[model samples]
Target: MRLFFPLLLSILIFSCTTKQKDHFEADIIIYGGTSAGITAAVQAKKMGKSVIVVSPDRHLGGLSSGGLGFTDTGNKAVIGGLAREFYHRLYLHYEQDSAWKWQKREEYGNKGQGTPAIDGENRTMWIFEPHAAERVFEDFVKENQLEIHRNEWLDREGGVVKENGEITSFRTLSGKIYRGKVFIDATYEGDLMAAAGVSYHVGREGNSMYDETWNGVQVGVYQHRHYFRDSISAYKIPGDPSSGLLPEISPNPPGKNGDGDKLLQAYNFRMALSRNPDNRVPFAKPANYDPARYELLARVYAAGWNQTFEKYDPIPNLKTDTNNHGPFSTDYIGKNYDYPEASYERRTEIINEHEDYQKGLMYFLSNDPQVPEDVRKEMANYGLAKDEFTDNDNWPHQIYVREARRMIGAYVMTEHDVLGAKAVPQPVGMGSYSLDSHNTQRFVTPGGFVQNEGDIGVHPKQPYSISYGTLVPKKEECSNLLVPVCVSSSHTAFGSIRMEPVFMILGQSAAAAASLAIDEGIAVQDLDYEKLRKVLLEEKQVLEN
Candidate 1:
């Protein structure tokens, strides 16, 4: 009977050894085509590692090419490695006369908008147009000859194949399999990290959870010009309680200050607009357009709020990277709470709803009689750029998913790290931006007035080192996976680290460690810090100030 059991065990082991090996294999597999994903792939190739990018979105750069040309670059000096190279390439592209199609380079250069587009001394342009940014990402792929598959959604249901705590392979919705020695979850959603059973948090953590003063729901903390300056009614009719709440105002009681909640901050499309009449697409009314949806906006305008063009930041040519400004502007608050964990189908529905809402808001601003004549006239001057985003009817393909699922990794960065109060061991990058978060919810105040809550911007005293531990999963959880975009950090710290430039920095650092791990045949978490730090410094990554 013992000999019979031994024979059965031998047959089971034999079956496992003969499993199929014919699949798309690489030294490293990246799951998203975000700016971080592209940069990670570039660094992997530079390290002579075979890499593949499995992207859900067709486009390469996420928000970098998706109308956020007015970059949130805090201190440009800290941006090094491939992240700085990207901006330098943009400068090279703009040096050519043909790059400026709508406006002359000379005229655009002297605008003195936010940051100079043509930095002659450093040869790096901080601001650029949407197409210009996309062109640079495409150039990187062509220059590196990296393999990329687009529109390939991960099969979240049993797609991640892990054997004895280490992921061996993963399948996409197309039934294609990808095998790699290491993987990077560079998506804003952190889909791959969650699929591998890694611990993560979606909503804001309680301030007490991390001893952070800026982590949780903030009600009266108004930092930007986005709060209501004048008291406005929250009812459909001026002062009627039974008339019910306005369209976007939430009725639920906002949680206590410094307390945690499952709600996420709002999201919006950073519209790439143009004042050039020859290269503009006028705002069109969307299907099922509702003017009543923007009744709050009209009330704000009636209360003498006319700062619609405050954040229409100028990019190259006559285009502007328009962002959310003033109370009840482009941010569609309290509508995307389920986005972090939503299924593919449900996420699409939420994105479509945001598109419709933004489209309707633009149409109302340009055509509605409720908007003041002066405000409407100024809004009409700017329209969607005709030459940009030509594939999706000139609308941006990527929505600004400001914050999403953050992994609880080997190290969790908090406000202490960002404020330089805590030591950052094994540094990989730097983030200098303020801890900024948009309004999470629009609610009726107890004073019977409409107000927006949850916008806070607290700057760090100086640039701080971002630890390498934030990019890696716990040793016992998933050893081979590295998360750069949705890194391990407290909500307060992530607000500063969530910038695109910082993502590229971490992505390159993640790839460097991945390549070293592959060379030593060790897990990413098990790699020695000195060895990885040596490679990063050699690649010109600024570790500390």
Candidate 2:
């Protein structure tokens, strides 16, 4: 009892010491370190605002650094400002011979759709490597001498201290108060905006809400060019019912399209892998890796689905940025529905599940007997690349929060914007990608077979303008906050606008709005677009055609 008392006292003292050490402050506090957050902070600094990026992530670049190295740039012509500059810097980095340390320059080539690199001779854009992208963000901060508070979470309830419609400052969870003239909620989740009394929505809006086809729960849409290799067969692996459904197959009914509710998109680590023995850290079995979890993958193999090893596109240094492959590959569907607005404790559970599932999936594919011999061999050839993200055992720290709490701002972008009906007058940027929503729910069909839905892929007829009003809250609501990551748009429209390039574009535009608000000493909602457009144009931000 005496020894226990002393230990408890020591723990209490250590807790006090730890609590004392975690306080910090900044002038302009940006609440995320995503590609968007980085661009926002860089733009703020460029505008001569005393800025400090308070990132929830330990790593600087969000998806760009996390595993989405394969840049999801839709229209390269539309990408400009610091967003374009980022890819340009990546092009410059790869131009050097030293950049090709592991593989020949010609051998290690880009496969995703994009324009060629610009050499100041021609107008070109859209090319990148993950590490190069992160380095460019780091360089921007270092060059500008900006301050960043990493791993700081915003106070969930009373973080934003707003007075008479203007945010005076915000406090962090650790009691660090950041008093600033203006605050930009650049986070993917929009925590700052939510705390600042700004309105937002989670999950998909009902189709009736927007009079749109793709806004709500799409239960029966199968639009992507994936799935079974041969014919869509009934659930019968040569006489096997007691064997049960595959490991990843969900047994829930895909809710009717247009119904609308929260559903999980598939999440996987965009593995940065290397063939070079030194650089590659083999995808070892995770601590809780269970072969049974990958039982469905084996079922997929038996059903003649063998297109798993197709996503490991090689980057420089013999490294590959591994992405989600085939129908039942990396996407752990039905497992992350509660992750978006979950508490830290709940989020930890979701993250752990994703890690365990992904790691188990890899282990099963590489070693399980049920897996095809060729498939296992091909998967075995790759492992978690060493030398990349050494801190987390090469695992990506950021879970791909595909869609989250979206702000329903003044002018909500809808199918009208993508279909070119209602032209957005206050164009801050443009998006041309197809309205692509990944599979939302998987199910067991009436025919006693597994199926999935909510994977809509309709290419827009033309590039659509994303309105500035979409980024700002309504004039009546909180007027100072700007939501760049999750802007006001219907789920269908958001599908096209939710690319990384678009996020960076919006980030720059949001920062410009914040700066304009400060310059004019007016609410962000009341800032004149004439002046905003002029500044955005000067900054090489493609506000319009």
Candidate 3:
């Protein structure tokens, strides 16, 4: 009986070995296709590592391809590695006559407004069209033979399995799994990091958490021209709550500043707009459009507001990547509070609500009788770009999920980091954008006027060093994970780190870590900084100075 039991155990062990060998394996698996994801994949290939980028996006580049073809690059000189290479490639594309499908090369000029399109020489471009940016990422992947699995969501629960402080494997909702030596959570949401059991944070921290003045809500602060016009009525028409709070206003209480809460930043679709009648699909009345919903905007207009439709400027091909312009603009604030961690079904509902609100705003301004005639007539001249986002009813499938779950790694970057309080020793890259935060909560002020809090735009004292440690998980946490796009940082710190070009820089650095970890067969946390720094410099990652 003992001999027979031993034989059965041996047979079971052999079967398990066979099953384990068949699981999908790669040197690195990136879990998002934002600009950061694409850069990480390319860097992995440069190091001769087999890689797969499993992206939830049907498209590759995140906002860089979505609608912000106009890149928000603060210090253009600091951009290096794959991020700079991307803009150089964009320049080469534009240098060709055929690349200008709509506008003449001379007509293009410098179109980034205040932001520089070219450096000392006209060899690099900082901004471009949406399709061109996507093409650049696609071209890079094709050249490198990097495998990309589009429209795949990482299963949050049990999707990632770690063994002895290293990520062993991660599975997707489609049942496909990927086993990698090292992994990067390049998604803006930091989903992979969370799934791997790493600690993270969300929403604003108090002023004391990081000694940041702009960490929490600041009501009645009108930084941008996006408030109600005097002619427009109040939330309750100066008295009537029975008339009820405005449509987009939240029912929940607006929490105090310097208080920790789970309020999410406002989100909006980057609309591709055009004036060409042949290509424009005139702003149609959304199916669920309601005129009364825009009562806040109506109040603004009644106050002689006229700053609408000012953001529909030109991109390549005579198209314009229209962003949110002013007060009560396309940004659907206070409606997406539950979205950061909501289920997929709930996320869809929130997205639909935003779409309805934004579309209805456009429709009301263009067609409703309540809008000023000049505003309506002017809005009537614009529509969604017919060629852009054709499959999803002229709407971007990915909403501008501005901020989400940020991993709390070993080092917590504060406003002091950007302010140059302490020099980061393991410098990977640099970010110079202001510690900017959009509105978080809207509330009735002591004076009875509705106002937004948590919109800060304080400039950084200098271009500060961003540490490589910020991108890596702690030694105690999962060691093989490198998070570039959503690296560990405080809320105020993330405000600066969240920029696209900065994300790309971090992506390159993360990939560098992955390659080094593989060569040494060590955890990502313990990689030799000397070797990593040498490789980054050779590849132009800009470690220091």
How does each model score on lDDT? 0.91, 0.76, 0.80
Q: Could you arrange the candidates by TM-score from highest to lowest?
A: 1, 3, 2
In candidate 1, list every pair of residues with a backbone clash.
Answer: none
* After superposition, candidate 1 runs with Cα above 4 Å error: 1-22, 109-115
Give the per-residue lDDT digits (tens) of candidate 3, residues 181-209.
89989997788898888888877777777
Q: What shift in Å separates residue 416 of candidate 2 from its native position after superposition?
A: 1.8
Better of 1 and 2 by lDDT: 1
Give per-residue lDDT, candidate 1, residue 393. Answer: 93
What's each prediction's TM-score?
0.95, 0.91, 0.92
Q: Give the TM-score of candidate 2.
A: 0.91
The most accurate candidate by lDDT is 1
Flag regions of model 2 displaced more than 4 Å: 1-27, 114-127, 228-247
RMSD of each: 5.0, 5.4, 3.9
